[model samples]
Target: MARDIADDGVIDGLRAAATADFETARAMPPEVYTSDRFLALESEHIFSKEWYCVGRSSALPAPGDYLTCDLAGQPIMVIRDNDGNLRAQSNVCLHRMSTLLQGRGNAGRIVCPYHAWTYNLDGSLRGAPAMSRNSGFCKDSYRLPQVRCEEWLGWAFVSLNPDAQPVASRLGALEQMIAGYDMTRYSEAFFEEHVWDTNWKVLAENFMESYHLPVCHAGTIGGLSKLDEMICPPGHDAFNYHTILKDESLRIACAHPSNDRLSGDDRRMTYLIAIYPSLLITLTPGYFWYLSLLPKGPGQVHIRFGGGMSDDFKGDADAAENFRQLKALLDDVNIEDRGCTEKVFRGLSSPLAQAGHLSHLERPNYDFARYLLDRIETGQGAV
Candidate 1:
């Protein structure tokens, strides 16, 4: 039998500790980072219910191109079918439970390696060798079960819950705020997946705030930001955002130098947003990068991260050299962040661990904690 999450008093205690005021709110307790029961509850209530970016639409541009991943314990595949439609389907073979796809590529048809059953790119059954011998076997009745998929701002997002709200409806005014970036034209430039040895929320919180920049990223991008310039304005029910104001102090050309149409702040600022449960994005005038996390356990997080450049950068003659330099800097930043969060995870397991007070700089993280409390305790939906 599986352990019960409802029986744990820790959930109630976490609800009580969460507060609206960032200055007074305590950080989420240690058990939420170490308990398997809490992780299971999160998978059902949060991961399966939220609209998350799987990757950019540019990745699988042609028909039959696909990407496969395990989401909230569901083996699923996303493909661009011959009909020029992006679709998500259960990766499980119709005949048995054998997974139909491995790593991503263009497949003429999804063929089950376990048996001879085959499925079309649109998820219809194409063939089942030797199965016609069975009486009453109807091939039309068995097609890959379809999952909900939607596209937004050049990215493809998937949700296991049929009743979940569309990603655009939930984003509210975020589109308007970021309209000048024109994210629809962005293409995949770099992509990689890795498992980090830290709690998923721990990494999510890192991306949600700029408080650690001075110490964690000092010699890199941090030096360009000022403590007073950071702002944590009120967030919507579906997302939280803050700005990292940059000055001319930047040592490297991490962002595009300019875009004539973008407003002044849009060219100079980097906006970091956490869209409930697990999608995190860093948007700037020239380029963008995103991190979408999947919790394997309380201690392991699977991360899919990639970045793309806007037309301003892509159109540059030196774009290739610029991307190489940008990726090197990004690789260094990721190394620094990974080290810091893994250390924090280890600290959470200490006997004396406690939910410390939050800082004004950590307001976005406070919003994230509130989102978690609302979903798990009050049943407040992720707008």
Candidate 2:
């Protein structure tokens, strides 16, 4: 059984250790944001332990359906057997730890090329091609080790820890908050990833603040938000999650003539939600975008972006085209953001760089730093 995350003392200690005062600085301590050891701690405690969005349930639409992914250095396979239940298992073959699958595909059973060890689509040992009877190995008892798996809002999440809490409990209020919108009805139209030469924290902190708009992202997002009304939301002050509203200028630009679903309140604002650890969900009138920051090393991170159209627009040709256009615009925003991130990473390591102050409107960045440090310092989410 997975441990109860809600009552875990470690999580409580993490929340309590947050330093409200430390967040006022220009940046986190040099080691906290740049050390290799610190980065590894996060991988173990944060990425490996938590429920990470690995793919969409739609990716495995039938029995014998499976997808392979490497998350936090662990190779995992997610499958929905013929009966339609989802299961996650180590992609490593029990026989020699060799990877069972290379990528996504349909397979009635996974067989290890090295040893002929085979596992059913549900991850049970189905056979061992040539093991002699005297070898004394029981196929029925040697099934692939199963990992915890769950689905929320069409996204499939898997936890390396076999005893982690259910996806619903870990997600808390996020489901209800987005319940009115159905993500399962949508389809992925765009996927792209790039290496960011900075600590994962740097990128996450950047997303939490709108202050960079007038400068860093000025060419792309600045004109869309009013310089003054772009203040950070107060929601970051608590353990509370945040979603930002897009200004009217950007809202109008995102809604194309092909998209009829952009009318009403949905067209009025852009929504940004920061899920703890490393998941970011952004909702626009025409589509929803998810960004996952997977740490590659001390000063490098893999950023993957997934874009999907609104459920209502999935079948409409014109609406789909508008969503594709929206994705292109988002890609532009990502490029603009990455350009600034590269420069910032260089500065963080320079002797000339000193800690800076937080503007009133950039308080969300403060909250993020505070939470990150708390998790690191206490070893609660240490990799």
Q: Quote the lDDT for 18 in model 2.
A: 40
Tens digits of lDDT, candidate 2, 1-383: 11112223433333443444534445554445555656666777677777777656776788878877777798989899878899898899988789988767788888887888888887788888777664678777787778888987777888887777777776656666555444555677666666888878778777766677778767676767655645455543122344445666553234444555446655545566666667777765556777777787767878767877765555565765666577777878888888887677777666555556667666666667665655555555344
- Top candidate by lDDT: 1
Residue 306 miss distance in model 2 (angstroms): 0.6
* Model 1 residue 182 CA deviation in Å: 1.6
Deviation from truth (RMSD, Å), model 2? 6.2
Q: Quantify all predictions' global Cα lDDT against the true fold.
A: 0.81, 0.68
Off by over 4 Å in 2: 1-18, 22-25, 179-185, 234-266, 315-317, 377-383
Each candidate structure's TM-score, on Cα atoms with residue i matched to residue i, is 0.94, 0.83
Model 2: weakest 10-residue lDDT segment is: 1-10
Candidate 2 lands at a TM-score of 0.83
